[model samples]
Target chain A: MDDFVYLKNVVTLELNQEKCNGCGMCLKVCPHEVFGLKGGRAHILNRDNCMECGACSLNCPMQAIFVKSGVGCAAGILNGILNNTEPSCGCSGNQSACC
Target chain B: MTTFKNPEKAHSPYILDFVPTPAGEVPRVTGKLKLRDVLGTFMVRWSVNRDNYRVSPGLYAIGDPTDSSDVFVTANYKLSFDHLRKSIDGLNAWILVLDTSGINVWCAAGKGTFGTKELVNRIRMCRLEDVISHRRIIVPQLGAVGISAYQVRDRTTPAATATLTAGSAGSTKPLKLSFNGLKVSGGFNVVFGPVKAEDIKAFIRNNYHATREMRRVTFTFSERARLIPVDFVYGKYKLLIAFALFFVLSGLTRKGVSFQLALEEGPYAVLNILMAYVAGIVITPMALPYLPGRSFAFKGFVSGTVAFVLTLLINFPGLNFPEMFAWFLIMCSISSFTAMNFTGSSTYTSLSGVKKEMKVAIPIQLISTIAGLVFFIIGRLF
Candidate 1:
């Protein structure tokens, strides 16, 4: 079922190859298998499946993953915009850390 | 964290007796919905019933399971478990609940909580090999995001297509999965079957046959409902505070001096905040599909404009030039701000696009709100 792909360039996931120690943590932690290890480095195999959940960034010990987290939920962003605060997941469902 | 008033009472009319498995002892259900179950379902759906909804992670017997029971896997999320149990009212099946940290199957699958590794782990933990005569699992269709059927064989990176038909005799050959895109032809995905208790047998039977048509799979009602809370009841706690702030601040001077009361200039204060809410929270989102904007911030701007006209007609019949100008800035910006917030909530919104829009939109919203607040104070005083 690997041929499946969602919309592209939506997720802000970035991998710093120089900083990556090939720990393979991103591959393991990612639910959608967005990353794959090649030549002892993490490669983004699929970009579209990334839901911007930020599990990889938190799990990445070397800080190799750079994603501006907490911008995924509209309700959170709405609250942030109206209340003048940072936006994140506002709904109780579909969550892990930030919006 | 709201607890169920009665945790032990069975909600499904079926009396659950203890059924022993290698993993642990579990309650065997008769597939009846209990009164408390109905209450719990509503409470949880509305965000009142908190944590107690979760069923323990283990194998559960439905309608008196045997070694031949078809093993259906799901998350420990109460709703997911409940759906499975409630659907099998008169049938015999085994439910294996995974530890998804209290998330439903479809969502947990995307999060990788309901994954192949965990699937293998649960299989081993339950010694499922011994319990079931035939080795097969019916995974939900949406779970393909996290699980590769090829992963079950411990093979290398899967090819896009691989065929292995079971029972090669006649037209009734064993079904095999063929993934072309989002749709799987001759596959083994059981999507809630969009089915209920009465149709359990047919749903199970349908999964066993190979079909070339994409007839079975479509966006189900329950699926869409998961994303949209039609009530707009979210963020109530914050709204209450904002309402109070508007009521109090509108009656006072910028320097905290007051000879004026809220009821006197109530229309000005109440209308401004209300217009903002309608523009952002109500209009932008409710009309999201019809709105003619690609960017959420742009949509918000449109909603804000609509709010301004409505507010003008309702509250300020003879609004002066400055009053019109100030209200435009404040009220429209409020609507615009809320519409932008909807970007984060929308599934279709792209993260990169939103970040870019925020840089420009946020500054404008801030400037407009500040300018509006200042003009409003000036208008009230002078």
Candidate 2:
């Protein structure tokens, strides 16, 4: 996992320090271990490692985390641009198995 | 009345038997995969019969689950269902399969199919309360994107004035119940399981606890390799069109474009495109870790250059310098674009990151391709 790194400083994940109560929910749901508890607040441990999966933000009880999360797939983004819709895995009809 | 579809006939070979429950007859499944199941996985890997690769969605019993047995929820994709069952072998459990339209859990969760609404609806439809005394359901960790744990634990639906249908197959008659003024919860708590099905047993053995390692997703060599077949099959029609277009373009000569010239130069042009395709779709994914650049587009460019150089040195088609350069441009652009698309199949990548990378890469690829075509025609005319 350490060796397989994508782009750096491009993640949109942001956590509000004031709202975080150090519940540790973000740390649990994040697949990339992007958050860490410091003192009594949740902090970004590794921003570059964040894949913006939305699990952390969705699970956070205090609504402290915010990220424009979606599938990081180039094909999905391209499909969205071409079709004039939100980014999707292009699993509409007939063509399947994008992810 | 809709005809009652037999579960055995609908989901043949997978259903071992049906166990009668208070709700209805729940199809019984086995953890041990049969020969056909193995073959089915192999066929899916190669994109054969892939669209129809799904199991019927409903409640299933494994190892004679009782009222106190843990109810594990999973996607309707046969692979997801199979993995869940196989991982919990020798354990008595109930499986609640959601209709993810044959997609795996994580992907379906991302798309909102393996979602909170679906989970709640399935639970009510299956009459899980009658079958199990416990008020807990275990979901995969990846499915957390679509399922809010607090919501599942607290959100209550108005269970009034709505007809509750039990089975999709019409085997069970529609039951009407009036629990007036009672706001009904999903009737269960959601506990997210480990990210991988292989860890389900360990998590269960440890009293339903998942370690940090189990929660993290990794893209190992085998994982990346498994995705190659599907990625390779993507946009194949576009590849064929590129071949057809290039095959005709190669026919351009000093006199005029003709089939004779195409016959002479077409093989070389087609071969170059094929090599580029292989480098991008196959070699790029397999050799991902070893590749030099962070950007998939850059990594693909490097691979394409190596391939182009090898072909030029060993199997030169005796073309002019301009024609060769044109092929180089074409190969790299094709490889770069295709490899960039691999970000979708990859385990870790952010939407912002891909969007940024594509903003730069797509324009360069387009310009290079157009320039290559111009150079190729100019060389042919001269």
Candidate 3:
């Protein structure tokens, strides 16, 4: 029922349907239910739902997905911009300086 | 005999000459060493000397450092050493490397492996007291948690400790160095920058397995996959229960309702449930930023109110004042409950904030949902 909508148009993921095997891996891994099964193939039903975690590509056996993943948090991104360093969501691989 | 490299040729503004040991006494290893480039930019390499197995992770005097040479401290991990050395183009500082289980300073400090005890031990092992005349040793600022300036001073005889920024160690300006130290006042102030965002995006993109777990719709899948006999049995059970509940409630309330009346009540109950579900999960996250107030509960209330109005318009296009007024209450209750459930995902809401919101929001949501369901059932039955 919340009327406020997020306006940020950051594209966090892409699906190459040509390479998709309809394995439903992306559907299962996405926290936002961004992908759904259609015609026996996976389709991005809601790309805006993506948080850009990049889990689908890692778990994809066929490598049919690609995304520019990082911490989607604004504060973390701002810090990265100010320091001239790469921004991280502090959950990529345990190398996080901030939890 | 090892010859002294000219101090003038190796002079750098960032590098200083500390006390030096006797020329022959200093251990020297010479060879064309090959280093593996790990993690893209960081290089991990080893040097071999006859009868000495040096496979990285140790302190070494690179080139010839004279007395008063700048003593720079670093992790024994070859990658850390490489990063430090690569930045110093012409500096001939004495590298004091500490064994950190082959991990970087920030992570090592977190794990407590690069703590105060280890730093003190490493200084003693290197005979830094005798090699450096100046009582000062420079450490990385990130390693401050594991090291206590007070503890290091009390433990070591005359050696004082100073923390430096990792990237700015090469800067020649004293003002810049001072500013770097002052800038990183706490763990949050440490410069993670865009690397954090990049890493988060990369993690989400690569780890599809986690996404799969999140998107599994248990309720819908159960409804779709169950076979005929089970579905038939469930249907019969539902009918029998509905009939029994209707008569029981009617008798208890001193009011009688026909079977058709009860059937009419069922559809509105289902719609309210559907609207609640959509508002809670779908609408909240999609429109998180523009919610009317900073408080998540307030935002949810606003969203719920909007949804209620939209539903009224769509469902009863030609309804009169009385009909519309009656439906408004039901719609408001359903939407409010849905929006209130959105406290889970919002970023600004802290744990305490969530707990507080839930305490008030939950009772109201439960009361409204139950009341709306009752009204829906009664309105249909009558």
Q: Best TM-score goes to which candidate?
A: 2
What local lDDT does model 3 show for residue B205? Answer: 44
Please give, for residues A4-49, the per-residue lDDT of candidate 1 as tens digits. Answer: 2334576788999889899775664454557889999998887766
Task: Report lDDT per candidate.
Answer: 0.60, 0.83, 0.45
- The i-RMS of candidate 2 is 1.3
Off by over 4 Å in 3: A1-99, B1-195, B199-268, B317-334
Q: Write the per-residue lDDT of candidate 3 for residues B1-382, one digit (tens) a residue.
A: 1122344423322223333464224433221123432332221111111112112333445556665555556664544555556544245556666666555554454445556677677666666555654545555544543454435655663321233334567643212223323431211111111111112223234541122332332212222222112212212343455445534433322255555544554454345435544554356445656556644455656666676676665666444454344445545554454444333223122223334455576577667656654654454344
Q: Write one digit per residue (lDDT tens) for candidate 1, span B1-382.
A: 1112345633434446767655456567656777777787777655564444676576667877776667777787777777777776677888777777676664565557777677666766666655655455665544443454535434221233233344553444334443332322332222222212234455566774322222122223343344334224444555577667666656765567453666566556676777776677667766765666666677878888888887788777655666678788877787787677655545434455666577778899899988987777676555
CAPRI-style quality class for the chain A–B interface of candidate 2:
medium
Best by lDDT: 2
Model 1 residue B47 lDDT?
59
Identify the runs in model 2 with alpha carbons over 4 angstroms from their true place. Answer: B1-11, B156-187
Candidate 1, position B45, lDDT: 57
The 10-residue segment of model 3 chain B with minimum total lDDT is B186-195
Ranking by TM-score: 2, 1, 3
Better of 1 and 2 by TM-score: 2
